[model samples]
Target: MTAQRSGAGANDGSTHRPRVAVFRPDDDRLRDAVALLDSLGVKPVADSMLAVEPTGALPRDDAAFVVFTSKTGAELVAEEWTAGEETVCAIGEPTAAALREHGISVDVVPETFSSTGLVDALGDSVDGSRVEIARSDHGSDVLPEGLWDAGAYVHETVLYRLVRPDDAGESVRLAAEGDLDAALFTSSLTVEHFLAIADERGQREAAIEGLRAAVVGTIGEPTRETATDHGIDVDVVPHTADFEALTEAVLDRLEGE
Candidate 1:
């Protein structure tokens, strides 16, 4: 069920900067998000949501093509695996940049930066070729399924598991209390984990209500669908699927209100 987008204009005639919750993993990503939000004049509530747990597994070496879907996956793979003759592909610029940071050359980066886009970018070239997808356990099934449909022999390696941090419910408390003015959900898993924590804290309904009243932003369609499925009214989704874009778009919406 989709609801009409609503603003957190709860502070209509006040001087309070919107308190936007960010659920980036605790690391440079979280810090960067905080800096971006602060620069945009929003009070960022830093909530570390996803934590990377490396599985210590490497991609199969005999594949004809290797695909990476995230910066974390790229970094993990680069720690132990070196790109050889297999063509390397990234889902987006950030993953490609991470690969390059480890001296791995990226061969393909789709214009649209999604599983469907990668399938279209690879086109008929993967026919009968062995392609290996290395990513976290929470990866969407779209990429592997699309590759198999494209006549590629696909192998998936779980390079890491994205676990919710032990102490991650601060934002949930804030939302349940109607203190959050906006929230940036970067992935579907983030949306799920956020609600899981809310449920744990016995504040799921209250948190959902708070988010619906606030400006909810997602990174892409998948994330938006996840939030909407959970009854959250998503107000902003930038054309670009990155934290900076998502944050800026949510900030713009908040400012407009």
Candidate 2:
């Protein structure tokens, strides 16, 4: 089926129908965002960029505090710990809600839903605490480093690996042909994997040239720095790194353009 547009005024004759392409894999966030786009009367084209794979075994010890930055991380931890002695700290409300659904009450919910937000909310609790971070294998070291800096004994268990999707080559090819108006990248891995796919399809430059790219409304300095290094002109980044904010950023950028 053809993708649907969302939100009125997206194509109200004054402006052209804006098309925003999402590079997230099949997940709840992507589905919800697409629904929102449809409500906004904007067409959304999806190309799976990252595939989450369960990586290693969970830690045996009952963690003092379990930290999760992404919903995927929370889900993995929930699967491992049917009932545990850990107090969960989530970076965002949605992830906290996800944990709550699994009978886990989050002890700390960050105000901003970013890694820095987690650190800020954690405060003294992180110091001298035994914290376990559940995340993908290729995630950033910021969380662990921040915990360590706070005097916490932090251990990271790889719950999953973010790998490039199998159909990424075809997606890159399509983007290179200007089939997409803008491509949304939510993570550094998304940026890396998308470029890798483009390279494999021998359309790296074309893909980059054909479409504008936007990062998840909020990202770390390192992620932004990496994007700049790769010559990607980031069109939008939300003040907070949440799906809703990211969607708004997309809409605003589309309107501006």
Candidate 3:
């Protein structure tokens, strides 16, 4: 179903609908993002920057608390594993929902949906517990390190590897030409991959300049920091680190501008 147009704002001064860049994997997520943007009356440039390569491994079976950092991880684990007696922990509601889809009961979901937030949420309770973290190979060291520092015996399983797709730079081309209106970056890796593709195309400087002219929104502080570190001015970061929140904030910012 199409979402209604956000009435008469960013498009007022332009002939065509604003073209926003989206960098989700070419799957249901990408389809949903494009649909959402279309519903908002914006043209979506769907450039999938990431591709998943599963490791064919499962989370360790002995931990007292098993942690899932993403919906992808939760779904992967559920394929061949069960919760058993362990307390299942998800980094956010999406992951929790994925776990539940597999009939796994989630015991914890942090108030904040980040590694640091999960560490804080587990708190003193993990002081003497065994925590198993299952996620991508490129996952941040923050979760494991924090749990280790908090006195939990932490084990990490790389369920997959996030690789940049070879042909994922259409958005970079659009940004370099100043034809794009906005970008929604969901993670630091997406920001990094976008820039890497720009550099490869020898349009890195031009793309950054074009992005500066358009609205750029990141899903969280870390993603915002990544964009800023690469000289792209980030216009918005939603309070919740999710795609829906990032999309709404960005559209709102575009309307206000």
Once model 1 is optimally superposed onto the true structure by TM-score, how far is the C-alpha of residue 170 displaced, in angstroms?
A: 1.0
* Model 1 C-alpha lDDT per residue in residues 131-235, reported as the tens digit of each score: 999999998888999999999999999999999999998889989999889999999999999999988888999999999889999998889999999999999
Every model: Cα RMSD to truth: 4.6, 3.8, 3.1
User: Model 3: which residue pairs collide?
Assistant: none
Q: Rank the candidates by TM-score, best first.
A: 3, 1, 2
Residue pairs with clashing backbones, model 1: none
Shift in Å, residue 161, candidate 2? 1.6
Please give, for residues 1-257, the per-residue lDDT of candidate 2 as tens digits.
12223444555554455556676767876688677776777676677778878765564465788887778877777755753677778888878887888888888887877777777778887688899887778768778888888888988878788887776654566568866666666778877887887787788898877655422232445566666679777766667776566777666665564
Q: Which stretches of candidate 1 lie over 4 Å from their true place?
A: 1-14
Task: Name the candidate, 1 or 3, with the larger TM-score value.
Answer: 3
Minimum summed lDDT over a 10-residue window in model 3 is located at 1-10
Q: What is candidate 3's CA lDDT for residue 143?
A: 92
Q: Compose the digit string of candidate 3's lDDT tens values, residues 1-257.
A: 12226634534654368788999988889999998897788889999988989999999999999999999888877868988899889998999999898899999999999999999998888889999999999887889999999999999999999999888999899999998889999888999999999888899999999999888999878788888998999999999889999999888887777
Cα lDDT computed for each candidate against the true fold = 0.88, 0.70, 0.88
